[model samples]
Target: MSLRVLVVDDHPLYRDGLVTAIAAMPEIEVIGDAADGAAAVRAAKDLAPDVVVMDLHMPELNGIEATRQIVAERPATAVLVLTMLDGDDSVFAAMRAGARGYLLKGADRAEIRRALEAVAHGEVVFSSGIASRVLSFFAAGSAKSALSPFPSLTEREREILDLVARGLTNAAIAQRLVLSSKTVRNHVSNVFTKLQVAGRAEAVAQARDAGLGAP
Candidate 1:
């Protein structure tokens, strides 16, 4: 099935350009476009697109807040943030806001297409630069317990944990393990509970320290 996409950005040219680019892809259909976060939310509700290309900055509602609202209201709709911001804070915030993809605005058309495809499939996709930041966060180690509750995690969860420690997004992990992004996300949540940790950092730390999910 062709993926229905909603392009959300404040800049008229950028929004139009992105929509045009994606619409040209045979696998995608640009069903809607919005100039701000509020518009994006309304369009999402009305159009129910399979994916949303969101911007970080916007008037009335920011991309992060918009993503949160959209995901909360429509869990099946994947939000892919296309922004110039490459900071770790932005990356993590978008992920926490339920973004399934985070790519730089400078990304090429092929990269953009791949990200949309990945997100549409329920995977989390991050640009290489953002991926590096995620990896750096993992390298810093966890502040929580040094050991993991190994037996508490299933085999699949363990595999997912390894990928998580390396800072691969849900989409990347799913692609690596040949599992659906939804399944990977479910496993990630399970890993958090098993490790008694709340966030990605702690989960990775516990998994690494216990030698439970290391590559």
Candidate 2:
């Protein structure tokens, strides 16, 4: 089934280019396009798309604020930010505002497609450049919080979280831990519950902030 998507960006040509590229993918459908953040929010409500391709810099509302509102109003709709801003602050802002994915504007069609698909499947995705920055930021944070007081995690949970910080797949972690893939998956679920977060990325972020692992 084609995933319904809403494209929002300030530049008409850029939006057009994105539509053209996305049209080539068989599993995606561009339900509508918006020229600004307000329009994006309205169209998102009207169209009820499965995902939104949002640009960070816009004339009204802006991507981060729009994402925050859309996510708050429609928790199922995922937002993938495709923007020129790759700075640490912008990346963090987008994530904090409920974006499920972030990627540079220069990303190739495959990368964009993968991000959309991942977010649609409730997974967080990031460009390699921004991914490195986030990882390093978390690593430094983990170091600083090494002495802070927090609830103690079981040894198994810590091991699982260390693999999460390394961005390991469930199957990869299972192989390393010498457990069944299903068992590792269950452990991951338990870890998220213990951490009180929704996804792998959030769990890893919390662990890093608490000085649980190296990047």
Candidate 3:
């Protein structure tokens, strides 16, 4: 039997492209398309689709929250996140929200199809790079806390500081973490104080020396 599918993305052209591609696959059927997270949730409930190809950065509701609600409402349906944002926060948020699969926007037709099928079969899936990121996060989580720099800050502060060390502006960090610019600024200030740094340059230098952020 063909697997029922729902495609959800803010961009009309991209959603159309996905529909066209999936239509050619004999094993999958596009049951519906939604422009945003709210509409996606409504359609998913009404269609009872086997898989939801979800985009994370939506206006009304983000994909992570949508995935959590959809999975809560229907255990049989699978959420497959397709997004451009590959930041650690975005990936972990979706995973914590119960997404079964993740793929970058540039995924090929075959990989997309495979992800839908895998999630429909109740299996977890992720793009090759995303898989490695997830694994590395887990590995880092077990490190000794006492040996870490900036022990006074919370994990969120550390994450934000790491992004800062990577040379991301507060605005850029906000976009990466799906947070408002004001919140990012607050985090940045807190990070600076905790690390005893007087300015952005000093904080960044400290963070880099501690080996934070991506390589």
Candidate 4:
């Protein structure tokens, strides 16, 4: 049977091109496509495709959250992340959100097809570069843990937490990091969620205890 696939990306040209390419594959069917993450979620529910080719950054809802919701709603469905963002945070966040595979936007059609097939078969997949990073992270092991106590937090989140522990307000951190106040606030919220802290003070206390705010 042909694999049912849904292509999700905000870029019109790229999305169309991907759909065309996937449609040409012998055992894959491009069942549907969505321009953004919100539409992707709704389409996944309605179409019930075997695999979802997801893009990380999108309007309405980002791919990570969308992947999480889709996987939660339909455990049988698999999400294959296809995004330009290949940072550790993006990769680990997608994995944490239940994505079955990760591939950079630069991947060729053959690689994308292989990833979709692999994930549809209950296998985890990552591009060569991403796999190397994952392996290195595990290899570092305790050495990495000693440097950063919160393995769950992303690099940006850890940076924000360190500043918070040093008594920097959100505005200050935003200015220091050259990010918008809203973005900083969102990161802070994510940090609090990951740390399981109730509020800023609690997060600060935890960060300090972990030696994050050290000058």
Best by lDDT: 4
lDDT of 4 by residue, 85-140 (tens): 87665677678779999999889988988999999999999999989878877787
Top TM-score model: 4
Residue 77's C-alpha lDDT in candidate 4? 98
> How well does candidate 4 match the true structure in TM-score terms?
0.72
* For every candidate, C-alpha RMSD to the true structure in Å: 14.7, 15.4, 10.7, 8.4
The residue pairs that clash in candidate 1, if any, are: 124-171
* Model 1 worst lDDT window (10 residues): 142-151
Q: Model 2, 89: alpha-carbon shift in Å?
A: 1.0
- What lDDT does the true structure give each of the candidates? 0.81, 0.82, 0.84, 0.87
Name model 4 segments beyond 4 Å from true.
142-215
Error of 2 at 28 (Å): 0.8
- On TM-score, who's better, 2 or 4? 4
Model 2 lDDT-worst window of ten: 143-152
Per-residue error (Å), model 3, residue 59: 1.4
Clashes of 1: 1
Distance from true location, Cα of 128 in model 3, Å: 0.5
- The digit string of per-residue lDDT tens for model 2 on 1-215 reads 79999999999999999998997898799999999989999999999999999998787667877998899888999999999976554676677778999999999998999999999999999999888866775687753323331223566877888888788999999999899999988888887776545788767665664455676
For model 2, the local distance difference test gives 0.82
How do the residues 134-206 of candidate 1 rate in per-residue lDDT, one tens digit apiece? Answer: 6655676731211223544566777788778877999998898898988888888877765555699767754
lDDT of model 2, residue 171: 91
Q: What count of clashes does model 4 give?
A: 0
